[model samples]
Target: MNDYKATVAVIGLGGIGGVAAASLCHGGCHEVVACGRRPLDRLRLERPEGEVEVPIRTLTDPQDASPVDWVLLVTKAQDTASAAPWLERLCGPATRVAVMQNGIDHAARVKPFIGEAIVVPTIVYYNGERIAPDHVRIRHIGDNDMLAPDTEDGRAFAALFENVPISVGLSADFTTLAWRKLMINVVVNPITALTRLRQGVLQHTDIRNLTRQILDEAVAVARADGADLKDDEAERMAQFIGGFPEDAGSSMYFDTLAGRPLESRALTGALVEIGSRHGIPTPVNTSLLALTNAVSDANG
Candidate 1:
């Protein structure tokens, strides 16, 4: 018999967290313990495939946690500090912690709390929303893949989702892959939040042109930072954003609507900072970052 069974702890029971926890349970090869702001009895994952409810062992206190084989940090990029206490309790020497968040600096964000080598940077492309405290609705439009760096830990992390509906794979050029994804985030998230519209807002020609400008700057920065991106990557990302449902909203937009702190620093602000380091002017992203920060500060 195959003898490998992973013990997993999923911190951050938001939309992405719920999906990750449900997928782990659906795989049936792991024992999952969930940690969130509050405890949940079970998780309801409504996927395009079907709906599956999985009972979860939930904990709200870090002291109640134990070390596990894997730790899936699924919080927004800005909430990494709030999630660190749980990481301290749940991460053992041999434990691999996968940061499933936005932007390109996943390892940089969590490496101080966990060791550098043990932090597996990951990117998840599926759209999901938490409709209830214990329920999440996953929207499957085109791709629902999780990309990780090509490493031993990355392979082991991908292996955890073998039979699950989610696709997990390694990126040979992870830096480029991560930057490419960040370029999309730079264009789509802040604009949607600022406009108070869904993904379909990009369908407007003016907004689409603005998005292309933002993405072009990000692509230039990524290339300077050693990411192998195409010259027309901006247009391609704009086309991809057009593919989302009309009512589909990003996590940043949802957070803004819910009056929570927006993740502008992690998304647009990071772009500006990196662009400056490379001596590239990112005017569009810089303006978006300032506007997003102003709105978030006023609301939050």
Candidate 2:
């Protein structure tokens, strides 16, 4: 059996990171060392039902964070470089780092700092937001479903959340899972940001069709990258998009609307790059990427 008393160090106490920290802490699995650039005591969390005050040791610098058995990197994909200093300090010989972020390049993004450390890529399905430095609102906790490569460490990681409210498991085909999530994000995120509408707004025939176009391009890219996805994955993605709350807004939408730096490159930009590699025409994704970049630049 895996030990439940391991220490977990969480870097980047933003929405996803904070919620995961809180959940892990509340589950009593590990002693959480919440590290960020700011004070942890001042960090607050907002839940859909109400606000919960998270009790965690806040470290302003990575050097101050205690080395632990595991480290969960929750920063945006674009912030990988900025988080390098923290990874350098928190990762130890046996530390297994779980990356809970978007994109399919989780391992490639953090390999520079953690080097041979066991890196597990996780697909986070929660909807959360940081309304303030200390306050985060979780719109949907959803299922704690995470897709990681099947290995000894992967099984151990899955065991940590077993019997808890979260569902963690190994994916024999992680590439397909990651690519599937990427395609879903490509279709839903940029469109919501551009239209300034929630997910449900895409129910309109025109919006739904446009979403399909985006998914079609992304699916081509995924197939080119050797992911085993069905040809009908794009249609399923559109159907999934329609199931979210009518007023549900994506993280990218919220970030762009709040004037925060959007993770455009990680989302749409990566799609275009991958599509180019496969010689697949990704005009729809390319257009969305261009539009998102334009909006980001204009806002800046």
Candidate 3:
């Protein structure tokens, strides 16, 4: 086991952040600090087995946040700017910031605040929902791992999750993994949001075909970006989504239905932009991005 004791601060106590903070605290390796828009005492977490009242220090303002060895950002990509102040306050010389949100542009997003500190890009896979102001329902305890490129700080961050159920591994080709996840997101998220349906609803023949098209476009974009993704990867992703519970709703779908701001730019929009840069046509993704943006604007 690695012998490193570092303070951890998790910004944005949403589904992913709250669970990560609790897991880190439960591991007894690091001092986990939970920070959010509201005060920490006001937060609560609802798990499948029972409700957990987090005891860590909670701060509503970034200025009130204490410096730590690592900062995990779990907020929506669009909310990165709002969390900047907290990031600045929580980061020290040796601190490392991990972006646990969606999308492939993790490093680029936080480069402004953390110039020297390691900005680790991580892809989180867990099915969780915020049931209340301080309560989150963890639907699935799927692999809670993070893949980082080979680096000293990346190795250190991986060691932190070693004892815990969360797996952290080093990936020489991190971009491919990220793009693969993005393709999976592209296939399932928009359709679920548009239809107000769950994962299993896409099992219909027509819906499945549409999902395949989206995945194909995303795969093309990934290839153009120098990420080697197989043609059948899209079908495999669709099959994975088909295996989920019939009533399971993705975070993107939930956000769309609730009239909250969606991660349009981070999800489908990013694919379209990258595809254009490589002169690769991504009509399906481009169309979906446009539609989602329109829906978000209409809802707003």
- lDDT: which candidate is best? 1
Candidate 2, residue 153: lDDT: 77
Error of 3 at 168 (Å): 2.6
| Lowest lDDT block of 10, candidate 1 | 137-146
For model 1 the TM-score comes to 0.94
Better of 1 and 2 by lDDT: 1
Ten residues in a row with the worst lDDT in model 2? 137-146
Candidate 3 residues 1-300, lDDT tens each? Answer: 867888888888788887777667667788777887776553465655566665667777776776788999899988898888888888877789989888988888888876577788887866656766567655444554567766776787788787665667787788898898898787778888878788877888898888888887888889888887887877787787667677777877898888987788888988988889999898888888888888877776
| Top TM-score hit | 1
TM-score of each: 0.94, 0.89, 0.90
Per-residue accuracy of model 2 over 1-300 as CA lDDT, tens digit each: 456677788888788887777667666767777878877664465655565565777777776765578888998887888988888888877789998899988887788998557788888776657766767655554454566678877787777675445567687888898888887788778888888888877898999889888888888889999899787988888788777678778877887888877778888888898788778988888888999888877765
Alpha-carbon runs more than 4 Å astray in model 1: 115-117
Tens digits of per-residue lDDT for model 1, 84-197: 899889888898999989988777788877653388888887776888998998765445478888888898888888877788878789999888888878877898999999
Model 3, residue 48: C-alpha shift (Å): 7.1
List the global CA lDDT of all models.
Answer: 0.85, 0.78, 0.78
